[model samples]
Target: MSVALPACPSCQSEDVVKNGRTRHGKQNYKCRDCGRQFVENPQWRIISEETKGIIDRLLLEKLPLAGIARALQISELWLQQYVNQKYKLLEREVQVRPKPKSRLRVQMDELWSFVDHQGNKQWVWLALDAQTREIVGVHIGNRSAASAQALWQSMPPVYRQCAVIYSDFWSAYELVLPSKRHHAVGKETGKTSYIERFNCTLRQRISRLVRKTLSFSKKLDNHIGAIWLFIHHYNASLPANSSCPL
Candidate 1:
């Protein structure tokens, strides 16, 4: 039997002509109807948006990379690469959204997790708006003044006009945050209770952040990506009134 011609993927037209062979030797075709060029044998497969939705949901559910692969019937390596690529897109999308000009009562804290293994500790710094229950900013690095500053700087300028700021007696918080706004309070006084509860929520939602769990992150990049994904989902899931910045 003779080989059949393929229609143009963009316009679904068979009015096509041979362009040339790609460097890899696949036959390239050009569509006369849509001016679209495509290879007869594409080197890259297009992943469907439905598959991407499943991946996003699974990620928010705190499934490990291997677990996600098993659920999707794809290789872990592919999922890993896809997540790395998609997360950068998500980060850029988040960065482009307009910042709301809302004064905030912010609570800041840090939680410890490990990358590579338990011996390699990493700190996840988080800032939350007490009124909105929205995670305003996140930073991950060593537990130091620099990391605290990074978290502080990530917040929008509008959020910096806080009525009060609460944190534990971490020296980094005292150094990085403005003295007038900062309150180093004990957990007993309930000053940091909201943030403490948020930390528990994070640990419950993200398996990698849980202590003594087998589903921990092996790479720091993946750790950050996972957290970013969770934060985005969590904020979106909140009620409209609850998520307002002010």
Candidate 2:
């Protein structure tokens, strides 16, 4: 049986024909209508622009790049480039996310993870919108009082005024978080559970953070860059002008 293929997207005409092959031997296509040329590959099957929304949704919902490649029937590296470029460019234009009205409690916590560095595990401090279950900000570095302060400092200027800040018995949290922000600490405080579970979510969503991966992180910056991509999409999925409900 002959494999059916798509006509050129630009031309929308069957007058499309294979022009030759590239160095990679991928069939090159030419459109008679517009004289435009393209390669017919899985990457082109779904236009990158259109796939950006799907890619964003997948990332927001915590789908790993491997999972996205499998589900979308595209190359993992191709999908990675698509997402990396799309959001990186998107981030430039948008910069940091604007703080939305969040009804849920906010929580902050840091976790110790290893990299190739010759030292002990570094830390990534995350601030989460407890209700929406989205990571609002992440601070990376040593977990000193200064590092902790730096992490919490990265939140959008607005969310720094969250109604409640939940964290473990970390003394540094008490130092920087203001009184009006209600800090829940001590062993008895149940507020840390949400952020702790969020750590598990990150572990599952990102291969680099996973305990067992062929490519476990060796660089802290790469670890943090993944978090950036994760947070951008996570915030986009929520209903506009409000925190994520459900």
Top TM-score hit? 1
Please, what are the lDDT tens digits per residue for candidate 1 over residues 66-170?
A: 888877777677788988887666671223133466555788899999988888999989888777777877898999899999998888677676546889999
* lDDT of candidates 1 onward, in order: 0.80, 0.68
Residues 8-52, model 2: lDDT tens digits: 877678777788987788888888888988886534454576666
Q: Name the lDDT value of residue 111 in candidate 2.
A: 75
TM-score of each: 0.74, 0.59
Question: Which pairs of residues have clashing backbones in candidate 1?
Answer: none
Report the poorest 10 consecutive residues by lDDT, candidate 1.
Answer: 92-101
TM-score of model 1 (CA atoms) = 0.74
Tell me the lDDT of candidate 2: 0.68
Worst 10 residues of 2 by lDDT: 88-97
